[model samples]
Target: MTYPSYRNYVREPVIKVAGTGPARSGTEVWAELDRAGRSRSDRPLIVVDCYPGVDLSDLRKVAERHLPDYQVIDVEDAAALPVAEIDAKIADNLTDDRVFGVLGRQTVDDFYDPDALRQVRDQVAGRTTPVVLVGWGALLVGADGGQPAGTGDAVVVLADMPRWEIQQRQRRGAPNWRCDNGAEDNLRKIKRGYFVEWRAADRHKKHRLFDAMDYLLDTTRLAEEAVLITRDSFQAGLTAAAAGPFRLVPFFDPGVWGGNWMSEVIGLPPSDTNYAWCFDGVPEEESLLLDVAGTIVEIPAIDLVLQRPVELLGERTYARFGAEFPIRFDFLDTMDGGNLSLQVHPLTDYIQETFGIPYTQDESYYLLDAEPDAKVYLGVRDDVEPADMMAALRRAEAGAEPFDAEKYINVFDVAKHDHVLIPAGTVHCSGRNSMVLEISATPYIFTFKMWDWGRLGLDGRPRPVHLDHAERNIQWDRRTDWVTQNLVDQVQRTGAGDGWVEERTGLHELEFIEVRRTWFTGPVEHDTAGTVLVLNLVEGAEAVIESPTGAFEPYLVHYAETFIVPASVGRFTVRPSEAAVGQELATLKAYVRGTERAPVGRPVHDTKEPGLS
Candidate 1:
């Protein structure tokens, strides 16, 4: 069984509060401290530990305003020594009693010896004076890897910021004294420190810090909002944490064939060029929002899957996929843009052997909007030779000649609402002038580009191509006839209700995912049936999703917004919103097949359906 990343595991914290960013005014900090009954003149020593590049000058000023006689100590000023010497210093400091009620600032870095941290925890125990430890890795040391530090009433707060903002600040020449390497290297170092080295430390300790957190300060947006985390709130279900329908924080990146649709529609800040992809619902890289007492707190989406695997994905799905959310929803904006690179994803065993991931990407494109004459490059010509095709791609890569993509690849005209299956090993790319909502398996970032249209990327460099990898995985038989017959979905009416109709549009042998479209003017009832369902309002203004027994909170969704219906929520209803009461609604829903599941394979012209057993 594949284990999930550390972020997946979560437990109810003693107390938790979330706010936007770490940057705050001294007055704000003073007010918060005052409210928490920590404003006494003889307040315990506040340890202010901070992540690299986080400025805490304002916080210090706030503390001093409340306690005029308080002293502030920067731990970095202490002499660095061997573990033995550090242990001695810690012992001496603990018994001194002279520094009681003094605030100490600790900078926990990758180089800090873990043993020294344990010593600090031991020294601080049984102290009458309060202590605050602040820093990115402060919890790792302060809590002794999540054990109670035995410092009475000690409150731990996390001042959090997004990785992108940190990188952006670094690019602007912000001081990152911890690294001697240049900006790019420093960025990689920070990522590795968090996602790799730090995560590999004591697992129990890692889990404890988050469980012990009293507050989380998020400085990702302007006007920082603080969220209070209480056990009552966490266990109260999704309604309490999410408040209502929520969207993950989306991220955009430019590509070789980047498009302008996202740049124009999303109003993203000016970048090198148009943005090409929007990670809308790829939970592994996306963050969800928890609105606690009116403050929005961001947490990795995987946390929900881990916290409620059976509830969110149903028992069967949880058993099959573990904590991994099997479905991925993202946007490919090729509108008013160039064609994507000719690419193919690895088959199941190949991805497992090459990348160690359990599943390969089995993707499909649901054209949301497409300009007249827009096309999709799919499969290869029936008469084309594999050797000749590889030779042409190589020639194009070398700039020897422009590759005529349509000469070997079959190009199909695309229209709005067309659903096309792009199982692994099928050669495919979105042609210019189309907005595609790509739904697929969760394994992303494994595309092997067989060819690019001989163009430079946004960085003004020739994009890399992976011909050998593509050749190994590509299904040579999925040519023109196979593409036209099997890759295209067949729409069939499945069910209907008063003023409503449902149709199954996609279900093939290549993958076990199923897609259905629903058109309704009134209410429509559905069941999760021990599987999670992802639905997108493709053709309506808005809708309200409610659990009949009030088992789940009512969710309000807008057009193009993607939402999940947890398996625990078994049966639910979707009705047009008040504004849309008289109008028709068209929604596209996707889920893994409950039975007759097929192993990942290449798309082929097969007429027989796979057996359930």
Candidate 2:
């Protein structure tokens, strides 16, 4: 899934808290802590083990103001290894590259000084009053990854931060962990988080902290007041939210080549800033906003994958991908903007061998909206030579000359609702004036940008071009003829109902994702079939997603909204909502290739809806 919307897009989608009392906040949070402390016989240890990039400033301020009597212990200052030591420790994962790094496999203890931790432990053990330990690895100071230890009675709280917020913090001059490099390039900061910081944080919490924590703390909106929820309520919120169709709170960011389509269509306020990418369904960086009573509790969407893997991703998917959401849906709005970078993704073997990632990025662009003049660069032209193309790109990058993209690339006229399957190693990018719904495997951010239209980044620096890497991955054999015949408009009408039609869209046989577009005026039956299904309301104003047996509350989806159905959800139905009762709406759904039911029969053609094509 990718990380990083419109139709008055629900800016903040919240899941109703079910089967539990609301989360504790304000003075109520302090009351819960005081009660726990008073009940303990020995010194009480309240440990808030935080993920990297958490705003410890806010946390400390809140703590000092609320629990004045508790002795505050900043673990980083007392026990964390020095920054130089940390750099030396994770240097293997933080490769020399600015934009990429290997996913780390370290634990919280790996970055701590054992002697310093023992000193802190002794200091805590000698305390007669309540001790509040905070920082990235505070829980490890007196407890063995959340279990009982000799540091007196402990109440563990996981101060978790979502990936998107961390990225925002990075952009706004926040360093990762204690590495004092806040002014680093945004790309390098994200790379550090993805490669070292986040992986270590996740490894630290995936089992130990998640299970042992007494409370889950909201580390989002660092500038605002933080919320604290009981661990039981947190788990309940996740369980209830993941059981049915749900949408992760989407994140939008302006890009150098962004467009105004999102602002105009999604009802974002008028601004010069163009919203280029809307991370609608990428769970890795998205958060689930849980509405407890009236307060909104924000938690990472990955919590469901980590805590409810079997239920959210289904048994089969869990077996195949472990605790991970494999597919992602996102938007690439180039409407009224410049073309995206001429980029190519690394192949599976290349990503595995070079980057240590198990999978490659196999993606497809489904047009949600397209200006008539929209042109998509898909593959190499049949007449272009690989060596010549490489030389041209090199010369262009060196500023010796401008690369003539059209001379060597296959540019095609695109339209709304067109599905363009892009397997790895195929050079591709969306041209201006097209709203693309990118559906793909989850390994984003490994793109090799061959060309960027010879423009400097908004930062006034040259956008890094990786022609050397691109040369290794680009599939030269995918010429114009092959692309035209195999990739373009490869749709087949699989079946039809009274008021609905199902068509199999192209994802190519080389890729693992399968997409199905359903055009309907009445209810359309859908089964998860043991795999999580993600979809978008591609061609409708509004539609209602329902569970056949009332397993989930009927969910309303608006035009361009993306939602997910857990594998355990089983069967559900989609129909036009009250406002769209008579209009024919369409949804483009994607899932694992083998998990879905076989097409009803042999393929048929030209069965598209009246407005399509």
Which candidate leads in lDDT? Answer: 2
lDDT of 1: 0.61
How many steric overlaps are in each model, in order? 20, 4
Query: Relative to the unseen true structure, what is the C-alpha lDDT of residue 173 in candidate 1, on a scale of 0 to 100?
Result: 57
Residues 1-613 of candidate 1 have per-residue lDDT tens digits of 1111111111111112243233233346435543443643244534443434444444444455554544433333231244454334334222322111111112234436666666665544434454555444555444323465323345555454444455456555544323334444343434433333222222222355446544445444332232333333444433333222345566777776677766655456798767788776665566666555554455445546556667777778888888668988888888878898899999999877654567889999998778887899999999899999999988988879988898999999988889888989999989998888899998676788877888876535566588888999989899998899998756776666467777777856678788888888988777676677788887777788877788645777776667776666666788888977888888888888762122211111222344211
Q: Model 2, 1-613: lDDT tens per residue?
A: 1111225468788898876666776767766876776676456678888888888877777787788888888888889999899999889898888788888888888989989988887887777777888898887776433334323467888888899988987888998888889898988888888888888888778857886788888878552366888888898898887789999999888888898887777877665568889999999999999987778899999888898988888777788888889998999988888899999999999999888898889999998888889989999999998999999999999999998999999999998889998999998989999889999999989899999998988778988888888999999999999999988999997777578788889689999988889898988877787778898998777898887688889999898899998888877788888888878899998887776433311112334443221
Lowest summed lDDT window (length 10), candidate 1: 1-10
Model 1 ranges off by over 4 Å? 1-112, 122-130, 142-153, 159-182, 185-206, 221-245, 252-256, 260-272, 595-613
